[model samples]
Target: MGTMAFGRSGASTAGWTRRRARFAGTAHWLLVPALAFTLALVVFPFGYTFWLSLNDYQFGHAARFNFGENYAALLHDAVFWQGLGTTFFLYFLSLALQLVLGTYVGLLLNRRLHGQTVARTILMSPFMMPSVVIGMMWLVILDPSLGAANYILSLLGLPPSQWLASPGLVVPVIALIDTWQWTPFVALIVVGGLQALPIEPFEAAFIDGATRWQAFRYVTLPMLRPTLLTAAILRSVDLLRFFDIIYITTQGGPGNASTTLNIYAYRRGFEFFDIGYASAIMIALMALVAIVVLALMRLRRSL
Candidate 1:
C-alpha cells in the first residue's frame, strides 16, 4: 500500500510539470500575432524605403540600382543645404520661444489664481486647432494688405509689413506662429512636472533662507531638467519634421526661403517625381531626427 501511494504521488507531480510546460508554450504562441503585425506594418515599410533610396527610381522611368549616387548628389545640392539650414533655424527659434514662454505660463498657471482653469482651457485652444486650419487662418490674418495683423499695425501707427510674402521674414513669422500654437502644449507638460515634484525640496530651500529667484534657479530648475528634457525631445521631433503648417501657409515659397527637409522631400518625390532621391532626403531627415532624439534621451538619462 505504501509503495503504491508513493508511485501515485510521483505520477501526479510529472503530470503537473507537463501541464505547466504546455501553458507556457501557449502563452508564447499568443505573442506571435503581435510580432507578425509589427513586422508587416512597421519593419517592412522602413526596409522598403531604405532599399528604394539606393536606387534610381523615378515615377515614369525604370528603376536602376545607383547606390550612394543620390546621397552623393545631396552633398553638392545647394537647395538641399539651404533647406537643412532653414529647418534648423526654424527649429531652434521656435523651440526657444516655446520653452521660455511655456515655462513662464506654466509657472503662472501653477499658482492658485482666480479663473485658472478657464485660462488653461483658453490657452490650449490654439494647440487643439487643426494645423491646416490654423495655417489658413493665419494666412488670412497675416495678409500684408487686408490682414488683421497689418490693420492692427496701422492702428498702432506702425508701417504694415509683409508677414509671409517676404523671404527674410517668412521663416521667423512661421516660427512665431508655431510658438503661439504649441506653447500651451509645453506649458501643460511643465505644469504636470511641477505638480509631480516633491514639496520637500522647495521647503528645504526656503528654510535655508534661499530667495525666491535663487531657489527657483538652483532647486526648481535642477529638479525640472528631466521634465524640460522630455518637452524638448517631443518638440524637437515635431519641429524637425514640421510640414503641414508650412506647406499650407508658405508652400516653401518666396524662392524656397522657408523650405525645410520635409518640403524639399515632398517637392522631389511628388512634384519632380524623383522618388529615389526623395527617399534619400527623407532618410537623411529621419537620421537627423533620430540623432537629436537620441541625444536628448541621453541627456535625460544623465539628469
Candidate 2:
C-alpha cells in the first residue's frame, strides 16, 4: 500500500511541473505580438530618423552620406540656438508654475467641501480635451481685437496689450496656455499620492497641536516627493518637445518669437525642405529630453 501511494505522488508532481511549463510557454506566445508591434511602430521609426540625420537628405533628391556635417552646421546656426533658448525658457517656467499651482489645487480638492465631485470633474475636463482644441479655443480667447481678454482689460481701465503678437510676451503666453491645460494632470497625480498616504502621521501631528500648514509642510511634503518627481519627469519630457499650442497660435511667429526646438525642426524640414538638418535638430532634442528624464528618474529612485 505504501509503495503504491509513493508512485502516485511522484506521478502528480511530474504532471504539475509539465502544466507550469506549458503555462509559461503560453504567456511567452501571448507577448510576441505586443513586442512585434512595438518594434514596428517605435524602433523602426527611431532607426529611420537616425539614418536620415547622418546623410545630406533633401526633398526630391538622392541622399548622400555627409557624416556629421548637419550636426556641425547646427552648432553654427543662430536660429537653432534661439529655438533652444526658447525651449528651455518655456520648459522651466511652465514646470515651476504647474508644480506650485497643482500642489495647491490638489490640497484644496482633498478637503471636505460641497460639490467636490463636480469640481473635480470640471477641473479634470481640460486634461481630457485634445491639446489642439485647447490651442484653438485659447487662440480665439486671446485674440487682441475681438478677444474677451482685451475686452475685460478695457472694462478694468487697462490697456489691451497684444499677447501672442508681441515677441516678449509670446513665450510666456504659450507657457501660460500650456500650464492651464496641464496643471490639472499634475493635480490628479498629486491627489493619487495624497490618498495613498498613511493617516497615522497626520493624526499624530494633530495630537501635537500642529497647524494645517505645518502638517503639510513637514509631513505631507516629504511623503509627496516621489509623486512630485514623477510629475516633473513627465511634464519636462513633454515640454521639451512642445509644439502644438505654439504651432496653432503663433506658428513660431510674430517672427520666430515662440519657436521651440520642435517648431524649429518642423520649419526646417517641412517649410524649407532641409530634411537632414531637421533630423539632426530633432535627434538632438530627443537626446536632451532623454537625459533630463533619466536624471529625474535617478533622483526619484534616490528619494
Candidate 3:
C-alpha cells in the first residue's frame, strides 16, 4: 500500500511539471503574432519617424540629411514654445476638472436609487457624441451674437461675453468641452472601483459611530486610490494628444491662443508642407507623452 501511494504522488508531481512546461510553450507561441505586429506597425513607424526627423525630406526629392536643423529651428521659434506651453496647460486643466467633477458624479451614481440605470445612461450620452458635433453644438451655444450662454448672461443682468472668440476664454472653453465629454468615463471607472471595495470595513466604520464623510475619508478614498490614479493616467494620455475638439472648434485660431503641440505639428506638416519638421515635432511630442506614461506607471507601481 505504501509503495503504491509513493508511486501515485510522484506521477502527480511529474504531470504538474509537464502541464506547466506546455503552458509556457503555448504562451510563447501566442506572443509571436503580437510581437510581429508591434514590429511591423509600431516599431517600424517609430523608427521611420525618427529618421525623417533628421532629414529634410520633401515630396519628389531625395531626402536630404539635415541632421539637427529642424530641432534648432524649433528652439528659436517663439510660437512653437508658446504652443507647447499651452498644450501642457490644457492637458492639466482638463485632467483636473475631469477628476473633480467625475469623482462627485461617481459618488452620486454609486448610491442605490430609482432611475440609476437611466441616469447613468443620460450622463454618458455626451461622451458618445462625435467631437465635431460637440464642437459645433458649443459654437452655437456660446456664439456671441445668437448663443444661449450670452442670452442667459443677459437674463442675469450680466454683459454678454465672448466665450470662444476671445483668446483668453478660448482655451478654457475648450477645456470645458473636454470635461463634458470625458467626465463620464472617469465617473464610470470610479464607480467600478467603489463597487469592488470590500464592505466589511465600511460597515465596521459605520458601526463604530463614524460619520459618512469620515468613513469615505478613512475607508473609501484609500481603497480607491489605485483606480483614481489609473483613470487620471489614462485621461492624461488622451489629453496629451488632444486635437479633435481643438481642431473642430478653434482651429488654433484667434492668434494661436488655442494652438497646442498637436496643432503646431499639423500646421508645420500640412499647412506649410514641412514634412521633416513636422516629423521632428511629432517625435518630440511622443517623447513627452512617454515620459508622462513612465512617471504614472511608476506611481501606480508604488501605490
Candidate 4:
C-alpha cells in the first residue's frame, strides 16, 4: 500500500511541472506584438538611416555607396563643427536656466500657499501651448520695432535693441524662449519628486537647527539627485534636437549664429537635397543625445 501511494504522488508532481512549463511558454507569446511594433518602427528606421549615412545619396538621384565618405566629410566640415558648438551652447544654457528656475518654482509650489492651484495652472499655460504657436507668438512680440518687448524697453526709458535679429543675441534669446516654455515642465517633475520624498530627513535636519537653505542644500538636494537628473536627461534630449522655434524665428540665422545640428540637417536634406549627408548629421546628433543621456544616467546611479 505504501509503494502504491508513492508512485501516485510522483505522477501528480510530474504532471503539475509539465502544466507550469506549458503556461510559461504560452505567456511569452503576449510579448510578440510589442516586439514586432518596436522592430517595425524603431529598428528599421535606424538601420535604414545608418545605411543612408554610408552612402552618397541625394534626393532625385541614385544612391552611391561611398564607404563612410559622408561621415569623413563631416569631420572636415566647418559649418558642421560650428553648428555642433552652437548646439551645445544653446543646450547647456537652456538646460541650466530651466533647471534653476524650475527647481525654484517647484519649491515654491511645494509649500502650502493660498491660490496654489490657480497659480500652477497659470504657470503651466505656456507649456501647454503648441511649440509652433509659441514660436509665432514670440516672433511678433520680439520684433525689434513695434513689438511689446521693445515697447516695454522704451517705457523704462531704455533704448530698444534687436532681440532675435542681432546675431550676438539670437542664441541666448532662443535659450530664454525655450526656458520660458519648458521650465514649468521641470518644475512639475520636481514637485512630484518633492512630494514623494520621505519627510523624516527634513524633520531631522530642522530639529538639528539647520536653516532652510542648509536643509535644502544638504538634505533635500542630495535626496533629489535622481529626480533632478531625470529632468536633466529629458531636457538635454529636447535641447539637443531643438529646431522648430529656431527654424520659425531665424531659420538658422542671423547667419548661422543660432544654427544647431538639427537645423543644419534639415537644410541639408530638405533645402539642399543632400540626403545622405543629412542622414549622417542626424546619426551624429542621435549619438550625441545618447551619450549625454547615458552619462546623466551613470551620474544618477553614482549619486
TM, every model: 0.92, 0.90, 0.91, 0.94
**Model 1 error, position 163 (Å):** 1.2
Candidate 4 wrong stretches, greater than 4 Å: 1-16
Superposed model 2: Cα runs more than 4 Å off: 1-31
Q: Candidate 1: list runs displaced more than 4 Å.
A: 1-24
Deviation in Å, model 3, residue 189 alpha carbon: 0.6
Candidate 2 TM-score versus the reference: 0.90
**Candidate 3 residue runs with Cα over 4 Å from true position:** 1-30
lDDT of 4 by residue, 1-303 (tens): 787888988898899899989988887897889999999999999999999999999999999999999999999999999999999999999999999999999999999999999999999999999999999999999999768999999989999989999999999999999999999999999999999999999999999999999999999898888999999999998999999999999999998898999999999999999999999999999999999999999998888
CA error at residue 18 for candidate 4, angstroms = 2.5
Tell me which residue pairs clash in candidate 2.
Answer: none
Measured over all alpha carbons after superposition, the RMSD of each candidate to the real structure, in angstroms, is 3.5, 2.6, 2.4, 2.3
lDDT of 3 at 47: 96
Q: Relative to the unseen true structure, what is the Cα RMSD of model 1?
A: 3.5
Per-prediction count of colliding residue pairs? 0, 0, 0, 0
TM-score, prediction 3: 0.91
* Per-residue lDDT of model 2, residues 1-303, tens digit only: 788888998898899899989999999999999999999999999888989999999998989999889999999999899999999999999999999999989988888899999999999998899989999998999999988989999999999989999999999999999999999999999999999999999999999999999999999999999999999999998999999899999999988889999999999999999898899999999999999999999999998
